[model samples]
Target chain A: MYPKSIKDLIEDFSKLPGVGEKTAERFVLFLATQKEKDGILSFSSHLKEMTDKIVKCERCHMLTEDTICDICKSKERDTETLMVVSDSKDVFVFEKMKTYHGQYHVLDGVIDFSKGISPEDLNIDSLLKKVASYKEVIIATNGTVEGELTAKYLKALLSDFNLSITRLAYGLPVGSDLKYADELTLNKAVENRQKY
Target chain B: MYPKSIKDLIEDFSKLPGVGEKTAERFVLFLATQKEKDGILSFSSHLKEMTDKIVKCERCHMLTEDTICDICKSKERDTETLMVVSDSKDVFVFEKMKTYHGQYHVLDGVIDFSKGISPEDLNIDSLLKKVASYKEVIIATNGTVEGELTAKYLKALLSDFNLSITRLAYGLPVGSDLKYADELTLNKAVENRQKY
Candidate 1:
């Protein structure tokens, strides 16, 4: 058997999805080899800070350090449009790109028929309440079946609203080779082409 | 950009060798969803504890919580023979299977020409010192060119001493289907067959 601390930490890390026992061992051993232990010790405090400080924003259901997320509180962002996403990771991805200038509404997860999930089970109520303030709601959920199903359901739910509703563009990615593009993506690229 | 704490923690976790940015995001999100946040928070402290607690055994060069590892300190294990391993991971593997009963000398790594590693870079000096007290030395390094080179070098180093030296058996692994076994392994299996 390994040292108690090594075994315990390996179990904790291995429980994370996608991390195997071998990877867990490597991580533990790596931490042990780090000469300046403070770097690793600080990681613990950060987890605690995230646990205690991060909260669900009441306005948009995004994780934040305050009652309302920074995006919802920002004046420079386009309050005229909102992006509807499935999780905070999606929000993080968009923020990393710094391309989108709109706020987001996290649905948490898409509806799953097998799992018996419905629109009411998600953050749909808050999204419905927040969509009233935006001129447009861009459905930015991923292109999976559940994501498509959730987008359709949201469209039906918000049909009577005065604002426009749009789904994310489906076509060839920005830098992908056209020859290697899948049939569905290639077809969508042709269908959605604009005037040159 | 995300919150400072979120971004910092993601960077730390992603810096681990095998963890990608996507996997790091999933790990962080999974920790955030834990019903009891202590599970993840404790992991950080455990890492610090490992850094402060674990040390190399002075006698055998194995990782231990004390100056002498349990194996080296044990009286029941064969004192006349010792197993030479590349790393603590190999020790853990033998322990997990309850197969090996001899003490271990951790070489840490082997000579690699491409990596510019030499015998001096490993724990060879300590191994040479320890091998003098044993009657036999078993080279248990992996079946790589570097491993064989190290074993040969160790054998030459211990030839002047009274101790006999041996290498681990190389043949087809037990329970492997002969049809799927590689040509080299099949050849070794036939070359090293024992009386049935």
Candidate 2:
């Protein structure tokens, strides 16, 4: 029982992953209240500016204003090592870790058999062409079944290529002691143990 | 450790209520991903437009584009009864209920002794002037101590006026059974029981 416009906004916001009715209501109310705190005109203008100006990088598919991504265009990055992820959000996470100076390729989604997604649905062809120039391709997809299947599919597709393909080494988590590692993690850790 | 611009945007989004670091990150990423979604730019632009264009109703302090609130400017509303609320949010709630037919007066805040807010700090002077025109005043503040105190202050300030003053009667909620009501509510229910 809110105004039609308010209700519509709430419904649209509620479609987000975690927002519920209460949160949706709070968000719309918050937006409505901002009209009083800051001039509503500026807020609306900002939204339009962001939507109109923000564009995706043509090369890496990450959000950027340039024709190519900063990572892909940067001479400082190791272009020979391409880190592939299912979504751009994963790129943000790794960027937060301040690790890896290699360029990135976002698939935008995993290859899902159940959903009828195939290799043709992914940006894998571009990746294959790029692999000719790169020495290594690192698959950083999630450890879920679909992610694993996608990784396997990519491996099979790139089998004829000369570049070295690698998956992130499975092991005990950084903070977790070896003794506290779960059975599955322990088994994977043992199987993938390094010489160091 | 994302890019400086990304970090700044995330920080700004995080200032909103109920949005944490992960959520802020997700929101930014979602905005970034909108490049792939159709009409997302238009939606964002619409939000910005609303924010930029909306203005406060000078009379009732509700968010609107007009000089006075639609309710206040309406001829059908009863000018003899005024409902006072602490904020415009509460005004929205009352409007949603569609139960009250009177105009509203926003205090913006309560008379908090600790906060050094007295009756003079609020729109009480204007409210007193409104009292002359109205036959009854209803204080529809929250069920908190500050709300009670504000209501009491209004009541005392208008004690000399010939008009009737009342607070909204709240007891057990509409859906709540008497058996499920708390002891405090049950006590209040018994104490304030009415003869039919």
* Pairs clashing within candidate 1: none
lDDT of 2 by residue, B1-196 (tens): 3544455556655766789988977876676566454354455554555555556677766666568767888899899898989887788788878888898888878878888988788878877775788888888877688888998888898888988888888677778888899897788777888898
Model 2 TM-score, 2 decimals: 0.84
Worst-scoring 10-residue span by lDDT in model 2 chain A: A35-44
Q: Given the true complex, what DockQ would model 2 score? A: 0.32
> lDDT per residue, candidate 1, B1-196, as tens digits?
6677676778789978878887787788766656687776787677667777888899887888989999999998988889999988788888888867888999888889899999999998887766778998999988899998988988888898998788899888888888998998889889999998
- TM-score per candidate, chains pooled: 0.86, 0.84
Output the lDDT of residue A12, model 2: 61
Over 4 Å off, model 2: A1-16, A34-45, A176-196, B1-8, B35-38, B51-53, B113-116, B174-187, B194-196
Best by TM-score: 1
Going through the candidates in order, their DockQ values are 0.56, 0.32
For each candidate, report what fraction of the true interface contacts it reproduces. 0.64, 0.26
User: What local lDDT does model 2 show for residue B148?
Assistant: 86
Error of 1 at B119 (Å): 3.5
